[model samples]
Target: MLVVSLIAFVMFRFIGDPVDQMVGLETTLEERAKLREQLGLNEPLPIQFWHFVSKAAQGNLGISYQFKQPVAKLIGERLPATLELSFVSALIALLAGIPMGVYTALRRESILSKLFLTISLIGISLPTFLIGILLIFIFAVILQWLPSFGRGQVVDLGWWSTGFLTVSGLKALILPSITLGLFQMTLIMRLVRSEMLEVLRTDYIKFARARGLKNRVVNFGHALKNTLVPVITITGLQLGSIIAFAIITETVFQWPGMGLLFLQAVQDVDIPIMSAYLLMIAFLFVAINLIVDMLYVVVDPRIRIGGGEA
Candidate 1:
């Protein structure tokens, strides 16, 4: 995470100058120099880096040249929307992926299973942007079921005025969420099916069968439990990627989330806002992985204690 942060920081600072960009080519030489000094752009690289880190540690994060507001405050205001989208997207992905994976695994040799596999493969092959567009075409253009772009008013700690879990919000969400979730679900489905298959072939599962254990208990209780470690790990990693993807999807959907802000900031070369946004995303990714690690220990005792003891 620190390495990624360093890379993002170095790229943003050294790759270009916000001062020069804001100054424009028409500005006089003296104006450019003055603006550079004003924004601390004239400082030595080491000093500038220190200044950024020190101010960041103190919760400053500098001020945006475009917005004329503290970067931290600006990010804080936008953070909720991003979080809302991310959580909703993840929920949709997991809900769809896990069950699909389980069913595919249980019926791996069936024609239906093969159809699912084909669909999953195609889904995994397609890009999110393409999927987003396709979804918009069907649901937005043809069906006239929901709005194709833009978010509704966020009120009452919810994304839609109808409600967070209401039919309207969920209906609006289906397209974007499924578009975002498609690739991830495809990947997770394959993983879960393969893992469950391996677990089902284990000697304990055979023994349980010999003992006349119910198929549900053998499959869901026994095989599923053993397969959870890898599922949990992959799910955590995918969550980080999903947040990044949601940024793109949000822009495609014209949603007022952190992703749209990041896209605009990049286009306008708003370095301060971009930098702060990148840092926040970095923190979210690290925090999510940490939570997943903790969950791993709780879900599987072998990871917590010495494997030899087990």
Candidate 2:
């Protein structure tokens, strides 16, 4: 994670100086130099990097070039909305994908199974932004059932209340969540189907079937339990992907989340915010991978046994 963060920070600096961008073209070179000095950008690259790293270690991401606020404070304010969107989207993906996958694998050769496979393929094929647009057109325009953009003004309600799920907020989420979820749904469905099929061919599953156990019992009880290990692994990976995609999906939906903030930062050359966002994303990826690794031990006892004979 440290290496990744360093690379992202170096890349952002190489891209351009936020000091100059913030100061504008009308400023003289001397004035720009002063601004650079003020921001510590005029120091040697390695020294500047070290300074930023030290500050970051102290939980200070420095000041935002755009907002002139501390990056940490800005991130703190926006983090909740972004996390909310990503979490809700992941929930939508799991709810839709897991059942569809189990059903498809159970009926492998049927027409409904073939249809699901086709849908999964298409879902994986489409870009997230395109999916967001299609959803917005359908739900927000044609049906007029939901709002097309922006979070609602129901902020007075308590955090645990349904304020975020109010008419406007839910409408704003509809496009982004579905858009981000479709691709993840495809991946999970395929993983679940393959794992379930493999589990069904195992000795225990075969024995259960031969022992005259009901199809539901053999499939759901024996096969599904084994299949769950891989499902859990993929779900963990997708949680991070969901967060990354939420950036794009949120932008497409014009929802006020980290993705939208990152987009604005990139366009306006807000280096501090952009670098902070990049580092935050790298951290999330590393953290999620660690969690997935730990989950494997919990979900599959065979892994923890080191392949020992029972």
Candidate 3:
């Protein structure tokens, strides 16, 4: 968090002047100086960073120069959309990827398995923006099935709003979610296939087969279960990547999410929003890793037992 804060603060020095963005051509030098002073842009770099860090620790992310609203408030409004998109994307990846991986591993010689492998390769090879564009062309343009952009109609529930409650909202999510998740799905599929093949070759798997355990039991109950630890780690990291890199997909879809906001901040040099985004993303990465570590114990008792022994 500290490192991220430092980087974000340093951006203010080189990324154009906020005062220039805020002031008009008619503003006098004295007015610009006063505005700078008020915004603390006139202060020493170290002093400004210190103030930023101290206030951020207390949940005060400062106000955006562009929006003229609190950074936290802006983020809070956008966070749900990003999270919902990411959640649905991750769910699609796991639900489709895992089963396909298992089938491909078990039926490597089958034509259907070969076809799946080809599709997975395509998913991995296509860039996200291109995939999004293709989906829009097919579904929104030619087929005229789903809406091409926007969140549709969002329903507000007190402090939070969501798109899941509306028909248009769900349709709007399909293209973006598939675009964001395709690479992750391919990755998870490949990893699972490789892990399953390796696990099947192990002595324990052979022993289970010798013991006359059913193939389904030996494959899913044993091999699949053992594959989950590494899968959990990768999935956790990928979730963070999805959120951090959702900028491209959001831009392509014009989704009102944090990634889109961050892109706009970059264009306008809105330092407060940029800084808050970095800190929030870093915190999310840290939290996800911690959760992955905890999941290790739950998924594999061996990890807990080994730690206890150590």
Highest lDDT: which candidate?
Answer: 3
TM-score of each: 0.89, 0.90, 0.96
Q: What would the per-residue lDDT of candidate 2 be over residues 187-275, giving only the tens digit for each residue? A: 88888888988888889998999999999898888888889887987898889878877887888878777888888888878878888
Better structure of 2 and 3 per TM-score: 3
**Across residues 1-310, which tens digit of lDDT does each residue of candidate 1 receive?**
5565566567668757677677667999898888778888777877877787777767788887778788887776666666666677778767877788888899878887888899999898888898999999998999999878765544454422322555555566667777778888888888888999899899999999999999999998898999889999998999888887788788788866678888888887888888877777787789889999999889888778957776
For model 3 the TM-score comes to 0.96
User: Which digits, one per residue and each the tens of the lDDT, describe model 3 over residues 237-306?
Assistant: 9999999889999999999999999999988889889989999999999999999999998998877798
The regions of model 3 sitting more than 4 angstroms off are: 307-310
Best by TM-score: 3
Give the Cα error of residue 183 in candidate 3, in Å. 0.8
Pairs clashing within candidate 3 = none
User: C-alpha displacement of 119 in model 1, angstroms?
Assistant: 1.8
Pairwise lDDT winner, candidates 2 and 3: 3
RMSD of each: 2.7, 2.6, 1.3
Model 1 gets an lDDT of 0.79
